[model samples]
Target: MELVEKIKKSSVTAFISRIPKLHLAAVAGLGAILLSTQLLSNNKTPERQRTTISLPVTVSSPSIAPTIAESAPQTNSAAQWRTEKLKIRNGDTLSSLFKRAGLNDRKMMNFLAATDDKASFNKLLPGKTLEFSLNKEGDIEQLSYVLSKLERYTFSKDNERYSLEKELREPDIRIAARTGIINSSLYLAGTDAGMDDKLIMELAEIYGWDIDFALDIRKGDSFRILYEEHFLDGEKLRNGPILSAEFINQGQVFSAVRYVHTDGRSQYYTPEGKSMQKAFLRAPVDFRRISSNFNPRRLHPVTKTVKPHRGIDYAAKTGTPVWSSGDGKVIKSGYSKYNGNYVVIQHGGGVQTKYLHLHKRKVKTGQRVRQKQVIGTVGATGRVTGPHLHYEFLLNGAHRNPRTIVQKLPKAESISTKIIDDFHRQTQPLVVQLEAETATLLALNSKGSQNKAL
Candidate 1:
């Protein structure tokens, strides 16, 4: 029995000595995990704890926002400018305009006193604009008076003083053409062809020396004109001067080309370079019709007796402006019992022109007048029936017909030979444009006629 006990003890001791090192290490690791859990529950962690577990880390840049305190002040150059615009209305005065702009009379006077041309404000037309750029203190940094789309006056605030600058914008000028056929009157024909009143009047004035618009218009008379159309922002602003024109009166073609000379004077000339402007205009006033022609054996309407009517009577409206026929000196301007208000002008080269029965004489007896200058207005102050102008043209003290005398008068100098090539170079393109337009018109008219026949 003692021998068996000793063998059992020895077997137990051998088993303890044969335990593996891997199992011992696993036991030690389990004990370490249990100790770490107890430390985490107590909220006591090491300052530098190393870990073998892999974790995801996202790399990104840090973001910071700016505050309002860092923004620039209103008075600073980087600050935004406030703008205001005001349009001028009819019957608007400087004070009224200023009041509308939230300004006082003193402020307006201060602005006016700063400007050199105060008279420009006097002609403040309606539909103009005034623009203002303001600073932080509500002070005007810049002020602009827009006179037109092409013109403006800018007053910039420089310290305490304001500097004025006139700004002008050049308009885009384009060539335009129109064709008109006269059936009754030139005015009606021109208007039907989309011509404005001013353009029609200018066309008449261009051909006034050769054609009698009031008396010489026929049923088949036609005209073609090339002129300027001023444009801004792709829209038509206004009609400009006539570039080239052609008028066929009584089967006679008369052409006039605009030529700008070296002296900066623009004049119309024939294709052969003859001046279209004669020394005398065809008629003194824009007359509606001839009330009475010159007749030596006609009976006077007032006298009830036979008398010689040396002057032609032009029937026109009262207050119609009468123009000087030529550049001359006024010899007599007075109101008489027979002539009423009359003006007698002595032109050069033994020529004299007389205007009778005027409403008001614009020129004095000694005032030198230019051609086309407004000398008087038509009136009924004379011993006559109604408002009519008794115009007399005297060649060396003999009464001649004003309408026929223009043909015999001296003409203005034509484009000189030195500038004739320059004239042709500038005006030929305009002439070709007119010709092309006319050809197209003719072709269209022919096609329309054929269509009508079909």
Candidate 2:
């Protein structure tokens, strides 16, 4: 109580009482206005705060406002680009893909104009992907088209103009080995051993010159291969070329190793550096069965009279394709009462091949065709009882059995002497691997047989 009475009676209170009440009220009002102004400035809109400048401008005669360029806020040049990805679908075009990605036609046209070569883009296949990078204003800054696992196209903006660039990625290659025994067919055994159709076909082709897979394959035939498998980012992309292979057909063992010469040509060769390819294929078509063999005194199916069946008859589906036995020029591609839709090819060394009773002919007279090229499809035409191919081989105007004659013909050329040492060095390891794998398979088969006998 004593402290309060002393403060009330102090000289500071007497001094304040002598001042005017209007002056005190004016001071208090001024303080309130200053606080309100600070709160309003702190809560200003983003647009107003971004455009606010410290500089003050005066308009002459109060008739002109600031120009848009001078008053607008500058955009951030270092903004991160936004990305969107889209996949190609059937019946999808470049314009449609761009529109689906929220891009305009003008931008797409600009990109196309910048691309010098647009062949890959023109043939846009399904399952490919296109990616776009956009700026803050939704304008394309960068674009990428992934055509396949190996090839890609990129379009980037440089100095306000777009430029296209191509990129290619090489897959990592690793050696792979597989072994299989044939119980019914090579195709079936290959599938059981986890081989794709493409790889199986390639395997057949590698040994086709010596073993006519269409006819020479037996129940106990087996094969071992040491090949390449391509991978990218730890995932297998596809299978590469065969490095080395060993095939046993009808109790005869054949081996081949792939080698690439210094001149960039690649082919399969034997351990002693001999080529694995022959001048001609033994069988021209994949036949199911042999309807008739080469018989001089055979009863014709249609006439029931003794006639010389010069060519071998192959039973197959009507549309089964017939391939040229070797590289040759078509001598005749015509239809006759005896030979329906036949094609005759004249090869080197006085050798000629005749394909009779075809449903459709693919080659014309005088057209040069390579070995294994489809010339026609099998059909039952003139002088035939059913859908079968009558294939004939001629040597110097005399008919010969295709199956037996092809085996006796001259072998393919051997590797050149200059690259023999290089070939041996590169292929020796692959041959060793193939042999090891084959030995392991043989051991397993022997063990299984022994267990069954016991």
Cα TM-score per model: 0.75, 0.72
Q: What is the C-alpha RMSD of each candidate to the true structure, in Å?
A: 15.0, 13.9
What are the Cα lDDT values of the candidates?
0.86, 0.85
Minimum summed lDDT over a 10-residue window in model 2 is located at: 49-58
Q: Lowest summed-lDDT stretch of 10 residues in model 1?
A: 48-57
Pairs in clash, predicted candidate 2: none
Q: Which candidate is the best by lDDT?
A: 1
After the best TM-score superposition of candidate 1, give how far the Cα of residue 169 lies from its true spot, in angstroms: 2.4
Candidate 2: C-alpha RMSD after superposition: 13.9
Cα-based lDDT at residue 354, candidate 1:
96
* Candidate 2 lDDT score at position 103: 86
* Stretches of model 1 off by over 4 angstroms after superposition: 1-102, 112-141, 158-166, 445-454
User: Candidate 2 — what's its lDDT?
Assistant: 0.85
lDDT by residue (tens digit), candidate 2, 141-202: 87888988898888888877777888999999997778899998889999987789889989
